[model samples]
Structure formats: structure tokens, C-alpha cells
Target chain A: MIRLKVALAMAAGIAAISSAPAFAAKAKSEEKADAAPIAIPAPPPGKGQIVFFRPGGMGFALGCSVNENGEKISSLGAGRYFILVTEPGTHQYSVKSEAKDTLGLLVESDETQFAKCKIKMGIVAGRPDIQPATEEEFRKQKSLKLVDEDDMGPAPGALRPAEIAAALAQAPAAE
Target chain B: MLAIFVATILSAAAVEAAAPESDGVSSADATEMVLSASLPEGGKAPLSDDPESARRDITIPKLTPISIQILKPLGSKLSKTGETFPIRLAAPILVNGVEAVPAGTEGMGEVIHAKKSGGMGAAGELVVTARYLDVDGRQLPLRSLHWAQSGQSRVDTVNTLNVASAASPLPIGLVGFFIGGGQINVAEGALADAKTAADFSIALPQVSSQQAGTGQELSEGDLAVPSGAVPDEAVDTESAAADVHQGGKE
Candidate 1:
């Protein structure tokens, strides 16, 4: 009887060892499922939404600083997105990686604009470029997870309307 | 009791023998050896200095020397030694069959050697060497030497003649055209078309492993050329001189 019991215990241990990896994978999937979905906030009166997103890059870890009208709004990493609600006007957006790439947009009221950011090989490392995103391209990225607030860095801290005004006041005129 | 003990020993031996062979060392033994080796070496083995490993790790693709045509013509009378001028690539630069730099990319060249036309017809010598190419907002070092005589001047003598004939009624304007003839006089900084002296191979330095981090800029040290390198054969100083002589005679 004791010999049979020992054999059963050994078999049980082997089975447990084999199933451990599957259990760990299940746990990871559960954690991913628990992550909150990205929510798009409604634009304020007379303001529109400007979304800057990087779908992918060769150097995925490189973060680029994104500035709106000379005021930095966020540092976006590859496969991450940042949304800003701003008053309708022409805003100058710049992405600074190895060099600065700027784009000007005439934002209209009650409309959402999407900018797709891509990383290109530079002489040193990688450079970031911001281009207008088509509706189809923007729709394809809807399922992507939004970047976490912690990874947004100190640039996002200056996104307030008063802070933007203060920064613009101190900024030199564009030559 | 002895029979049971022998049976147990036989079963254990059979199980051990059934374990799969892993080359020479058993799987467990190999794992243990790797772990121990890693621990003593600070969790990473020293990289091998073999040629294959070095090539795999640090090999940078050789950039084909681009053909540059001078936009602003260089002349001994106007161009001085050590003067920097702008140039344009005649053809795109390809690396591993992919276009790395497009045609018409602006480049900068330095007048390495120049001698103005002196009395006795010394055949004014001008040797210009390409310094670097402005690619995608980055300055990539390029090396090519072009030698020319005053004959290759792109100055449209016919056009000047036409202007001179048209302005003959105005003697003051005719003198201005004659004086400015065969001279590049747009401004201090201008691009003139010139010919490439030799085919140059662009040698980009290997990207350092440390610079793999985010936001690293290419430093000057990365562009140092290797010593004792042979020049590319595509340079035809004879042809360049002949073209210049032919232009000077015109």
C-alpha cells in the first residue's frame, strides 16, 4: 500500500511540474485582460482633439519629445499614444529625436486629428517624424493599448492651459 | 528484502540510461556548467575576438562612393585653395542594393590645391576634394578628389557673347559682361557644377555598442578614416584634367 502511495505522489509531482508553465502563461493573459482600455475624452467647447501616436519602430525604446506651438506636451515612446485637446487654431507640432521634425496643422472645431509618428534611421541613432494620419490608418490603431501616464514623463506636466500660456510667453518668436 | 532492493536499483539504472544524450554532457550537467561559468564571469561570458564574431558584432556596411557633379564651376581665377564649396550628387548612393542617399543631395567640397593662372601659361591647377555629404540632415563624411584645369569652366561664353552683342549699343554693360565672363559671381556661398575626380567609397564607422542607447549623437571620432587605405580606382585624374583643359581652351 505504501509503495503504491509513493508512486502516485511521484506522478502527481511530475504532472504539477509540467503544468506550471501553462499556469504562468494563463496568469499573464489574465493580467493583460485586466488592463484598462483606452478611453477617448470628449473635447471641450470650441476645442478639438489632437492625437499623436507611434505605431512601431526599429528602436522601440527610444522616446521622442513632442512639442505643440513650442511648448512640450509629451515624450512618446514607440507603440504609444498621447492625446491633447486644444482650442481650434493653427498649431505647430514638433518631434525632437536626433533632430527636430515639425508639422503645422489647422485644427478645426469639433474634429479629431491624428498624427502618425514613425522612427527612421539617422546617422547617429533614430529620428522621429510626425505626419498626418488617414482615417483608415487611425482606425487600425484603435485596438492598441494607450501609453501609461507614468511613462509620459515631465513634459506632460506642462500640458495645462496656463502652463502653455506661460511657456509661450517665454518662448522666442519663430524665425 | 535483497530482491526488492536489487529491483529498485535496476529500475533506477534503466531510467538513467533512458535519459536523452546531450552531445557529451547531460542536459542537467550542461545547465549547471553554464550557470557556474556565468556566475564567475559576472553573468556574461567575455566575447570572443575571432574574426567571424567581430564581423558579426561590429561590421558596418561599406557605402558606395557617390558620384558628385559640381553645380558651381570651380576656376583657378575665382576659386582659392582651402575654399569650401557646395556640390550635388550625380547619382544616388546605394548600400547592399538599397538606396541610402538620393541623387541631388547637397555635398561640401574643399579646394585642397589651387594655383591661379600665372604668366607663362602654367596651366592653372585646381584640385578639389569632397569632404562630406549632407544626408537626411546628417553630415556623412565622403572622400573623393577632383583635379581640373581652367578649361572646364562651365561659363556660357556663347550666352555672354550674345549679351555682349545685344549690349554693344550700351558700351558700359558690354565691359561688365566681359569682366565677369568665366568667373562664378553669384554670391559668397553658391553651388557650382563640377566633375568628380575619382570614385570614392564612403567608409562609415561601425556604430558603437554603447551608442545603442536612446538619443545618442554620432560623434566626430566615429568618422575617422582607417590608416593605410588604398584609394578607389574610379578616380581618373587624366580625364578630369583633359576635360578642364578642353573647357579652358573654349
Candidate 2:
């Protein structure tokens, strides 16, 4: 009887351990399905916006983190993008890896701009380069996804996800 | 002596005027030339619209292409990143077959990137973007001017030479290191086409309100704010109306 009880407890423990991964996998898939599409709204009055993206290509394993000043705004993984609303003025963004490249943009009120990051060959590892891009170029990449909220740092100047949602809600619906 | 001096001055002026010119006007003369060209013919009023039609606003739709010329020479070697240069319209902006913004209206262009040629066969590069056109003392945003150019690259030639020299002991490939890439240069008056960045609504200049029964002209104060100045009250009303319409849609 003792041996049977011990055997039963071990089997139960093994079953729970085995089922945990499957349950986690199911939850992850559900979350992904719920977050399929992300809509970006027009910038508010007196503000300008920029969309930064990284298309999956060479150096896919490396992260292209956009930084303003010294703080990390967000990490642009392979095939990911993020929108940042900014004040009307000059803004400089930089990406660093084995080397660093910077791009400066003159933002105006009620304007939307785009920037793209690509990996280039460097002396050590691949270097990240940021350049001015257009809306047409951005749309060419068909499989772009929104950067995960967890990947963002304390970007005080940027619009948060909650703010984006509120703005989208206030925007007029598409016909 | 005075006659000779006057003759010399006249000859110099004649030579300058008769010189073979390139695309656009000189930077120093751009504003004056544009202003004089845009002025009303025969010193008449600038607005040609009838008094009744002046009350309406003219909308310049988005993505309307405007031909512009750079006022000065630009190049990867001469330009620095983040610099703004003067530009002028090469053609007039038409609305309903009438000239709205005339040729020579001043605008601004910004250098987004400028990299001089570097060693090791790297080429010089330049990228410039149009910012806005100054129309009636207001900024009409412009965009889609992705004027970019790169100098000739010598990487392949350098690599070939290096491979050929590898078989010999003289290191002849080292000559490739001295060869520099070309520079991109946009001469004065070069065309840099741009498009309207967004929908721009310009308020037309309104005539003075006629004094009823007196047949007298009203004072300037009674006239609707001159061209392009949309009243704050009117703006607020428009915003309110837009909000109401959006709410109704929801």
C-alpha cells in the first residue's frame, strides 16, 4: 500500500510538470492573437511624430535600440516598429552596436516622419545605421509588428501605449 | 576720366547680364527677383478674385507637386547636415485654373545627410529634403523631396588591383588607397521637386465691408483680416464642428 501511494504521488507530480509548458504555450498564443493589429493615430495638435522600424534581415540576432540622449527609448527587434510623438523641433536618434550611427530630423507640427534601422558590416560585429525613411518604404515591409511594451525603457518624451490607445479612441473612425 | 569710368561700369553690367546662365537665379537676387515677378501687373491689386469670391478659402490639397529650384549650389562637400537653405518655386500653384501661389515663392530645404568622401573607396553622399514654402506669411508644409546622390565607388577596382598585386611583391594595390570617390554637387537653380505635405487652407483676402446706404468705403478695421490670417474664433468653431461630426460618427 505504501509503495502504491508513493507511485501515485510521483505520477501526479510528473503530469503537472508536463502540462505546465503546454498551458503556458496556449496562453502565449492567445496573447499573440489578441494583439494582432496595432493602429497609430494622427499626431495631436502642436506635436509631431516619428515611426522607427527595423526590418528583419542580416544581423537579425542583434537588437537595434533607439536612444535619445543616453536613455533607451525602445528596442527594435527584427520586424518591429514603434511610434514616438515629439515636440516641434530638432530630434536626434542614435543606434549603437560595434559602432554607432546617428540621424537628425527637423520635426514640425502636425507632421509624421519615418526612420529605419539596418545592420551594416563593422570591424567587430555588425553596426546599426539609422536613416531617414518614407511612409512608402515603411509599408513595403509587410510583416512589421509592434514592439512589445516590456522592451521599452523610461522614455519620458514619447507617447505611451495607453496614450496611443486613448488617441486612437478619440480619432474619427475610418469609413 | 569720368567718361571712361562710366563706360567701364556700363560694359561690366552688360557683360554680367549677357553671361550664359545655368538653371536658376543667384541667391542674393532670388528674393528681389521673386517679389518683383510675383507683384500685380501694372501696379493693380494683388488679388484678382472678385469681391464676392474673396470670402471663400482656397484649399491646396495634399501631395500637390510643386517644382522648386535650389537658390544656391549644394554638394556633399559644401553642405553640412542639418543646414537649411533657400529655395524658390519654379512653377506657380494653380487652384481652379487661377494662380494661387506664384512662381518664385520662397521655401526652405534641409540637408538631412552629407558625408564627404572617405578613404578605402567609400563614396560621398548627400540627402536633402524640402521643408515648407512661405506663402502669404504662413508656412505651407512641403515634403516628398528625397533628393539623394552618392559619389562613384572605387571598391571593386581597389579590390581587383589588390588581388592582382597579391601575386607580386611590389604592393601595387596601394595606389588604390589614394583614389578618392566623387562628390555630389547640385548647382544653383537646380530643380528639387516637392509636394504639399498636407491639406493647406489659405483664407482669401476679403474686400472691405461696404457701408450700407452711405456709398462710402469702410475702414481697414472693418475689412476681413487680410489674406491667410484665419481668425482664432473661426478656428475654434471649425474644431468644435469637427468634434461634433466625429462624435456623431461614433
Candidate 3:
């Protein structure tokens, strides 16, 4: 009887040990589901838009601040995105730290574009690089959130949280 | 044909305006004047008058596949992000039985990301993109050339060796943790494929413009309209604030 009891106890302990990781994974997925997804709206007529996002990775503490001609546009944190509305023309976007990387894009009217910022190993620190991204790539990142207003630059292009909400409201409801 | 020709001229004009030393208006005006002089009203554009101005438009449709050959060797440990390399067309772009862009035309490629192998069995990574082709002093943008590669990861092998060592009579505890991954490398003359980003109408000289149709004169309407649109100012702050509060609740 003692031998049978010991076997059952060992089996129970094994099951608990295996199930703990599954339970933790389930809890993490549940927590992810709890965060509401932010909505993106179309650019107002005659204007172009760019969605700048930085996915969470090795350099989570680094700030990916986007700039235009040396003027700050927004601080793109890890796992965060911001919308910048601008005139339809060729615009140059840049990010810098120990080094600077620039991406030139031809923003078109009534078109939505995406730029991805990645942190790579630099000589002294992590360097942020911006590259053109597609909409499919943008949708693949599920943990994106709107940037806080305090992180925005003094520039007049980036949409604030309030502006994004209003734009979403004004956008005709998706069929 | 006329619409595409006008658009190409305007595109060239835009490139001129974007130059650092350009005042934006004079160069564009000069381009317009040159275009107007070459194309008289109600007359077919002089297709073969001067070798320089004898170029005719040939529309390279969007998404046309292009093969390019890298001119130099590149490696994750040896390359840096944003570095540019010389590249050449590996094959001629045939449009309607004629070579539009020849095989020897040179272009530029950019390194998007390069990370050398690190300690703890981390692998090296490299990514590159085909930026553009200089087709007769005009920049023909290319896209979809995103190529990524990773070095052979030593993690699995190191783990197995470490486990075997730890199980030995004289155990070496986790010695594999000091090992590093391989460095990724791409040899010179490597072939890559990319596609035209958009519908680009390139000017081919009349000698090779047998299939090209007659070009049209540049018109005032053909000029690119200056982008004057500003951001929308109207915002429903109250509703947005409420929505933000609701999001917080979530």
C-alpha cells in the first residue's frame, strides 16, 4: 500500500510540474487579450500618412525618436507606434544615437505607409535604424500601442491620442 | 503615353528640386523650358534630333522582376548598417522584344541590418535591400529586395556537448556558454532578384525606341502641384478623452 501511494504521489507531482508552464502560458495569453487594440484611421484627403513603429526586442530601453530635417517628430518606444500626417512629397525620416540612419520615402496622397524602427548593436550603444515596411508587416505585430502624448515632439505632424480617437470616430464604420 | 511622359518629366524635375544646391523653382522651370523646346505644339517630339534629347519613353510595368549581381563581398561581422555597395544588372530587362534596361547597368544596394555573432551562442544576422538603379542619370527605384540571412547557430550543438560533458565522470559544468555563433557572409558576384517599385516610364534613346510611341509636349498642367495640404485641425476632444478613459478601463 505504501508503494502504491508513493507511485501516485510521484505521478501527481510530475503532472503538476508539467502543467505549471501551460498554466503560465495560458495566463499570459489571457493578459494579452485584455489589452484593447488601438484603431488606425485613413489620412485626411490630399495628405499622406506614415505609421512609425518599433517592435519590442533586445533594446527595449532604447528610444527610437524619429526626426525630419533635424526636427523631432515623435519618440517611438519599443512596441509602440505613431501616425504622422504630412504633405505628399519625398520626405526624409531619420533616427540617431551613436550613429544616424536615414530613410527617404515618397509619401503619396491618400496613401498609408509604414516605417519600422529596429535597434541594432552599435559601437557604444544600440543604434536605431528606420526602414520602409508594408501593411502586412505592420499587422503582424500584435503588441503595438499608441505612444503617450508626453513622448511626442514639438513638431505639428504626429497625431496625438485624442486626435487619433477623433479620427477613428469620424472614419466611417467598417462594414 | 503622353500622361506617362509628362509624369516622368515631372519626376525628373522633382529630383532636381530636391538637390541640395537647388532653389527648387529655377531648375524646374529650366527643365520645363527644355521639355517645351524639344516638343513643339501639334508636332511629334523630335525623337532623334540630339543624342541627349532623343530619348523616348518606354514604360516598364510595375513589379517587373530584375536580377542583380553584387559587386563586393559582404558579411555580418564585416558590414555596417546603411553602407552602400555597387551592384549591376545580371540580365537585360526586355520590354516588347527590346532591351529596356541592359544587363550591365550599375545600381546601388544598401545594408539594412548587420549584427556580428555574439557570446552565449547568439547567431549573426544580415539584411540588405536593393535601393535604386541609375538608369541614364535617372533614378529608377526598386523594391522587394529584402534578403535576410543568419549564421549557423551553435546553441543546439553547444547544449548537447555541455549535457554530455556534465554527465561524464569528470564533469565540465556548462562550458558551452562561452562558445559563440558563426558569422554570416555573402560572397562577391552573388545574384539577387528585385522588382520595380512602380510603373516607371524610362526614356530610351530613339535608336532603341522602335516600339515606343510618339511623345507629347510638356504642358502647364503637367507640372507637379506643390503640396500645400495641412493637417486637419478638427478634433472631438471630449469624446476622445472618454474613449481614452474607456481604454484605460480595459
Candidate 4:
């Protein structure tokens, strides 16, 4: 009877040892499956879509303001993306920090453009660099989250209603 | 016996605790795993549409010097330091002897330095840098440097003509000289348009897998041949000789 009891206990221990890894793996996988889904917005008809995304960054908490034609679009954080839909034409994109770096993009109608933002060491803090990104490059960044509305900063030097109307009036017509 | 059984149970518990956890999974998979369980059964989240396939009509040449032209002329009046401007290829850029960037394909240039004409015969100065070549919908950041001067040469030529006219007997000579000087003033735009002073020869990196067994493995100190060596027809004798010397050393 003593021998039988010992055997049962040993068998129970072996079973527990064998099953632990499997349980742990399942739990981890379950944790991952619980992450929130990202929603990507579609480009409006006859307009182009520009996605400004920052992938991996050493300074994860650092952020910089992005401006389009001198109007502040959003403050982009690390591992985040912002989307802008505009009429296809020439657009000046700039990232503002200790100094500003600018890129001239000729947006084509009905096309999607991807720009990657990176942070570099600056005199005061990190400066942002925006560059054209290939589709494959953008897709490979798996952790890129969409910037939420609350996280977006208000447009700098907030334009009055008339100024906003004038600016929109001057903008090219969307197809 | 009970003591042995207890020891066995403890050993098993230790082994279970020591087993490695799943820590190295890709972020994409992890994200999918987190969201997938909440998704309705058999329903899938949408992915961003893939970019349009690169136009296959244009073939990439192996290695060739790309010739570009300044479309929008840079001068003291129009360009300021750190200002960006547009440019175009004067001729189609060939890669491996094939057309890569067609003529008139838009490119970007920057004025690194610019100064308007100061008093005391001080000529205007301008230094321009090429930024990128927009090739077939791709903006390839330039890895090479190209610079050109305009105002100084025009200034020198004007001074030479003025001195020559002053020494001449005819009044018509002075009038002609002034007109020529005016032409020189306009020459800033013309020089950039007419002169073929800038050429970019880029070296394409050899794919590591393709380089296997080629005896072309290069170390940090080894200077490899420029992939975009100008064709023999295009290179002068001196340049060809230099290439030969470099090749021999390699």
C-alpha cells in the first residue's frame, strides 16, 4: 500500500511538471489575443492618403509636432501614426523641434503615401526626421498605434473661423 | 518512502517553475493574439491595403551615372540658405546602361549657402546641394554631393569686359560691353541650364547572398570598385587610367 501511494504521488508530480509549460504558453497567447484592434481610415474619394508613422524609438515618451503648410496637424508620439487626407497636389510637410526638417511631397490623386518619422539627438532634446517610407517598411512596424483624439494637441496659434475659412478656400479642390 | 515522494514532488515543482516562458514572439503576432480572441468567430480584422505594385515597365539598370539638370535655377534673388527647390534630369539616367529616371523626372535640391551681390565688386555666391532623385515614384535620397557656382564667374567676366571696353576707342564698344554685362547678370539662370556640371554616380550594394563564392568579400579597409563606373565611351583617358590603377590594387 505504501509503494502504491508513493507511485501515485510521483506520477502526479510528473504530470504537473509536464503540463506547466503548456499552460503558461496558453496564458501568454491569450494575453496577446486580448490586445485592442487598430482601425485604419480610408482615403476620401479623389483625395490622397498620407500616413505619418513613427515606429521604434529609443525615446519612447518623446513627441514632436507635425505641421502641414504651417498649420499644426498633430503631435506624433513614438510608435504612433497619424493619417491625413487631402486633395492631390504639392504639400509641404514639416516636423518641428529644436530645428525644423521639411519634406516636399507631390501627392497624386487616389494614391496612398507613407512617411516614417524618426527621432535623433538634438542640442536640447530629440529632433524629428520625416522621410518617405515604402509600403513594406510601414507594414513591418507591428506595434504602431493610431493617435487618439484626446492625445492630439490643438493647432498652434489657433486660427480664427475666418482664417480657417480663407485657408480652406485657398486649398485646391478635391476630386 | 514518504520523504522520497515529497522530494520527487518538490523537484517536479522546481522544473515547472524553471521552464522558459514565451517571451520572444513578434509584436504583430502578439497584437493579433490579443485582439483575435475578442473578434467574432470567423470574423477577421482588415489590414491596410498593400501599396500598388511598382510599375514593371521601367527596368532598373545595373550601375550608371545619372545626369541631372537644374530646372528651377538657384540664385541670390530667389534662393536663400537652407531653402529647398526643384530640379529635373537633363537626360534620362541609365542604370546598367538602361534608362532608370526618365528625362524631366522631378528631383529636389537645397541651397546650402547664398549671398546677394555686396558692394565693392563683391560677387553674389550660391552653393546648392542635391537632395533626392524622384525615380519612378520613389524618392531616392542622394548619397553623393554636387555643387555649382554662378555669380562669381559672371562677375569676373563683367570686370574683364569693362576694362577691355575702357581701353577701346569706339563708343559702340562700351555700349556692347554693358549689354554683355547685362547678359552676364542673366547668366546665373543660363549657366545652370546650359552647363552639364553635375553628375551622380551611385554604387549599388552587392546582395550578400549573391556575393557568396565570388571571392569579392570586402573587409572594412578594402576599397571596392564603384558599381556605377561611367562607361568607357563616357570616361576620359585620365579617369580610365585611375580606374585601372584602383582595380589593380583591389
List the DockQ of the predictions in order.
0.01, 0.06, 0.04, 0.01
lDDT of 1 by residue, B1-250 (tens): 9999999999999887665443586444544443343332233233234422222111113334456766666665677766888877777665444344578888787765454532211123444566677764656665423232232221223334434755677633233222321222223333333332233333233223332223233222222112211112221223323322332233
lDDT of 2 by residue, A1-175 (tens): 9999999999999999999999999998987775655466888877878888887766678899999998899988878898888887667788998877777776766667788876644445656667666676777876687788888768564566787788889984111
Candidate 3 chain A lDDT trough over 10 residues, lowest sum: A120-129
Docking class of 2: incorrect
The candidate maximizing DockQ is 2
Shift in Å, residue A163, candidate 1: 18
User: Against the true structure, what is model 3's DockQ?
Assistant: 0.04
TM-score of each: 0.33, 0.51, 0.43, 0.34
**What residue runs in model 2 are displaced by over 4 Å at the alpha carbon?**
A1-38, A157-159, A172-175, B1-66, B71-78, B94-101, B105-108, B116-127, B131-250
True contacts kept of each: 0.00, 0.05, 0.00, 0.00
- Residues B96-168 of candidate 4 have per-residue lDDT tens digits of 3434456877778776555454322333445565567775466655422324232432233433444565587
- Name the lDDT value of residue A41 in candidate 3: 84
Q: Supply candidate 4's per-residue lDDT for A5.
A: 100
DockQ of 2: 0.06
lDDT by residue for model 1 (A92-122), tens: 6788877776655545455566766665444
lDDT of 3 by residue, A1-175 (tens): 9999999999999999999999999999987784545467888877879889987765689989999999999999989999999997667788999888777665655667777887655445666766666666777887798888999998586899888778888985111
- In terms of TM-score, the best-performing candidate is 2
**Model 4: per-residue Cα lDDT at residue A170:** 64
lDDT of 2 by residue, B101-182 (tens): 8899998999988777654454566778888999989999997675755666554455566667769899787776676667
